[model samples]
Target chain A: MDLSTLSLGQYTFVQNAFSFGLAVMAAATLFLWFSRSHVAPAYRMAITISGLVTAIAAYHYLQIMLSWEAAFSAVGGTLEVTGYPFNQAYRYVDWLLTVPLLLVELILVMRLSKSETVSKSVTLGGAAALMIVLGYPGEVSEDAGTRFTFWVLSMIPFIYIVYQLVVGLKGSISKQPENVRGLINGAATLVVVSWLFYPLVYLFPLIGLTGGAAVTAVEVGYTIADIVAKAVFGILILTIAMRKSEAEGNS
Target chain B: MDLSTLSLGQYTFVQNAFSFGLAVMAAATLFLWFSRSHVAPAYRMAITISGLVTAIAAYHYLQIMLSWEAAFSAVGGTLEVTGYPFNQAYRYVDWLLTVPLLLVELILVMRLSKSETVSKSVTLGGAAALMIVLGYPGEVSEDAGTRFTFWVLSMIPFIYIVYQLVVGLKGSISKQPENVRGLINGAATLVVVSWLFYPLVYLFPLIGLTGGAAVTAVEVGYTIADIVAKAVFGILILTIAMRKSEAEGNS
Candidate 1:
């Protein structure tokens, strides 16, 4: 499992894959942004946000791959020097960047469809501000304590998203939009599942589950799940955006 | 790791939780069906499908909990077992039931907006059918050969999903909705990440990654992911359904 032992060719391959993925993601974001004006205004915002979030995630992953190589080089081909901070930084950056975007996308979709009662523009503006406040600092440090602090700060927005989803689901259900309720429920499920990992990561050390491959596996598993959540929610938001535009065109 | 020594109270707690979850799911289904006429026809169908799928998953989890108790009792109050066929059955059932619904939900959303091209529907339909076929026999046995077959078959729908998503993403980028493209990309990412476990689970025997807590953890992790996926996608479908209805109402 000593990743540092990887040959130069293998290291280059990993680095290339990471960079290429990020590049494609950036291209996708720009493409989406340019096309936004052709669609409904609300959906335009949703796609824009989705694109930005995807770019952020791609950047974070790229950083992880680069750091992996750097840490390996630092150890001169040894895996024992503890690049754990790099790993932690990757996870924190991921959560801070993607989760709030997901929330905003949902709200924008609801608002575009006129299903949301609140002034969505104002709410979304507030959420964006909160995301910057929470996420920016999270990406600044790989220190365990600082990362943990940012994670707690990040939870404030996470909780707000959950509340919005619950209320949205209820409102949609009241209007007999059972399908929307179902979608919100699904997105909320991921939020809850992703959050479940946080306490485990932070609290497991207290219960002595904080070492070895088990801990590593937990971290990896959570990271993968978070990625899946982003991907799934991102698509859901995109679908909503498209539907909103089509409706506008028809009208 | 022998689960057989569990006191009556622990078993009862699991049993009750399973039952309560199932009952709530059942009620949700009935309510969904009953509310159909009050909603738009397209969304009505989506809601029905989503509700049914969720109910099925809840039932499978309940069955797993009950079977775990049965296995414990059969083995003279010990949790250790030679194999966990019942657990495997539940897992396959959960996948077989949900993956198709997810595909169908996506198609349904497009259909609601009357934006789906015929070829896209055909492709999605074919994938949905394959998921059911692969998933059905997966629940039959937990033998290594059977498990391998199940995993291979399951991959068909997953791969198809990835393909459809790629196509959809490209299409959205070129001419259609930006949000739709975003959603497809997101779903494609999840499909890839979730299926990463298939090879791991199937190949672990060859690599000697099997046994005790490791095996249990993998199985449980997959199950949780499955549940989370179903819940999230189910909600997404609901969102699309609601948005479509709102559009119709406004029109």
Candidate 2:
């Protein structure tokens, strides 16, 4: 947990995580900003909410980067940068806010009945926040048992989210225009697959990987997963939304 | 480069890369196999060829993993696992064979005129192979200047491939069945974007990151990019092919 003791490799790994996170944040923001006008009125709320998720994430990542830089500077030339443990709290905060909205946007883009949208988003989104809240304890837990327990607890909601997307929403997704049915399935599956990484990351210590190896694996894994889940998933959602909007116009 | 000399961190990095590559290979192969029956007759060749690309890469990655394990055992248990430099030649070998085929599959799936497909595949695929071949010397070069020189040289072909995909193929792509045009464009753009990582990976050593840091960066970067380029691109290609074939059938 001490930033002062990190090896150069670990330092680079964390820095790269921040860089990757920030890049995704910026790219997603720019994409949503530029493309929002092109989305349909029915889909515009989803697009705007998508932009909000990235914008919020971008801000939080900037704070994390600053924390990283501060820690790096305090250590001067030494790879074992001393001082504050870069507060990763910013990431949890970011996810707590954005994760639920991710599901909300998906629901919004689907154009289900208002009551259906509200009920699904509230239930799924609340579970998403709880997933983050539960997983955070495991992420910070030093004991293997505690981490494993938290991981299992988090997966309860994670599994539910996947089930809701895969089974519960199957009908709604099928009702989408044929052109976008494949993409709708792809987006849902992408979320389920990518979100599975968090629990895997939490179990790294149990697998006997500690120090820089564990650190690098967890950070890099999460970064890759986030890119797929947030940035790539967002793009898929946009594509589906655009296609459906166009289809409705033609019809 | 010495597997025996690798720190545990380096060992883990290489092992993770191998795992990732093999996983991608298996996933892509399984996807193509399962979907082959469903894809249209005209598009079957592309799906089959896509599976071949991953199958070939998987076999090569298995070899790379064996070489790594051999080196690790020879080094014994020391963190400073010194001596044997794990051969990365397998990667270049894999790319040389598969990169060209990637382009060919793309061309095939598009179902362009036979003459156009042949010419574009030969030119683009040949250039893709050349890019990897040209870049390999620089990858192993101890001298940064040699590395940068070769990296830039490789970019000549890389740029041409991009140009061919983006500009030269524009007309042909535009003629694709209307429903799948966006998907086709997405696939082509994915290729151009993902391939850009190669030159960037080449520049890592030049930026004063050497040894394990540079190795990990380059390997991890390439793995991520390759997944995007090959596996993800294959999926996009399949989706496009499926949609187009379905549209044709309905018409």
Candidate 3:
């Protein structure tokens, strides 16, 4: 269950997944930051928040990757795992930070009133962070029942987050320019759909894939979801903000 | 290596990667086909080509995934890998078909003169397909020298693709409305940068990571590039085409 026990393949998959995610987060952070000049001033805050989300994720993924490397080095290349440990807590720490900022970026781009934005962002962001913190225990649990329990508990906040996005934000989304409304809705849809992968990934072990298959599925699934949730979704936000910025500039 | 030797991690990774690519491609194809009401008639051809690129890749990825499944079924939980053969040619085949179409999609979006569009698309598309065909032999080569030689050959065409996008297409891109021009340029840059990963991935084996590390880097790297080149870039193209479509409607 530790570094020495992992096959070279497992190690490589985990290592590459984190490294690639880190690279993407870093690149997206830079892109979001530099794109400010091309967007309207009103949309700058959203852009900043998007950059902050990826920047934070990049730092945390680096920590996770380094932790993995340290664990791997402790055991060398032997396949008999004894006590080498990796710190998966880094991922929880990352989601705790990035997930909230993700919601905030969405809210800011919506251009809601100050009070409405504050209330909505705080509520949704809190739920997002809570979902991550709550899911961690489940992810590391050895007992399937314990894992499922934490998963169900995490779903409470996840459902609320989805509700807030799909229903709670509907009015604001509908009010956007017709062309952009589809994109805003699409962004929200992406959040809901991509996050669903987390729960599915959590169930990999329950279905009796406790070996490399389960691990591979979980790591690869999460990697794909993370890219979609963070980078791809970030681009969607940029598009929305850019269109809005241009509209304002022209008018 | 054949199917028998592939680790569960490898099987799972390949299966998941192809499946996910298929889903993204299918979704994009549906989106393009259904969104005709939202785009100008002139832009629809570009959108359709974007859809075609994904559609072709999707079909190929499905074949790749099915081949993996068949290979897995043959082994039936025997950890020792044997003579289960899975064809990687599926990738080369897919790329050969889709890469050219990718360039054509870009050329189409420019709304250049009929003769100019046909000439540029044919030239660029041919170069893109040749790049893939030339690289395939290197990918499967045993000797580092042979791989490098083929890589250099591939790069010749890659360099030409970049030149075409940057210099050859400059006039058409520059003539776009200011805002859309930025996106069009960004799209061109996305092609250049994302394609750069292909070469770096090629160097994985030369760097002495010839085992799981090499395989991991190549697969994960290509998956990331494919997403950017096809899905992410397709979205950018859609954004540009949509904006131009809207401008036309308004004017």
Candidate topping DockQ: 2
**Which ranges in model 1 have alpha carbons more than 4 Å from their true place?**
A1-251, B1-39, B73-87, B112-157, B168-200, B248-251
Candidate 3 at residue B146, lDDT? 92
TM-score, candidate 1, is 0.43
| DockQ ranking, high to low | 2, 3, 1
True contacts kept of each: 0.00, 0.00, 0.00
Query: Model 3, B163-230: lDDT tens per residue?
Result: 98889888888888886999999999999999898888787777776654455456656766887898
Lowest-scoring 10 consecutive residues by lDDT in candidate 3 chain B?
B73-82
| Local distance difference test, candidate 2 | 0.76
Docking class of 1: incorrect
Candidate 2 segments whose C-alpha is farther than 4 A from its true place: A2-6, A73-77, B1-251
lDDT per residue for candidate 1 within B11-110, as digits (tens), equals 3334333433443344345334433544577566667886777778767766775676455432232234334433545656666566666666555555
- If both were scored by lDDT, which would come out higher, candidate 2 or candidate 3? 3
Please give the DockQ score of every candidate, comma-separated. Answer: 0.01, 0.03, 0.01
> Compared with the true structure, what per-residue lDDT tens digits does model 2 show for residues B1-251?
42333467777776889888888887888887578777776677687777767766676666567656645543465564323335566667668767887898889988988688868887998899899889878876778789889988998998889898999889998898888888888888888888778777668668866676666767777778877888888888888778877887831
Candidate 3 chain A has its poorest 10 consecutive residues by lDDT at A78-87
TM-score of each: 0.43, 0.56, 0.57
**Which pairs clash inside model 3?**
B3-B84, B4-B81, B4-B82, B5-B81
Of 1 and 2, the candidate ranking higher by DockQ: 2
B68: Cα error in model 2, Å: 38
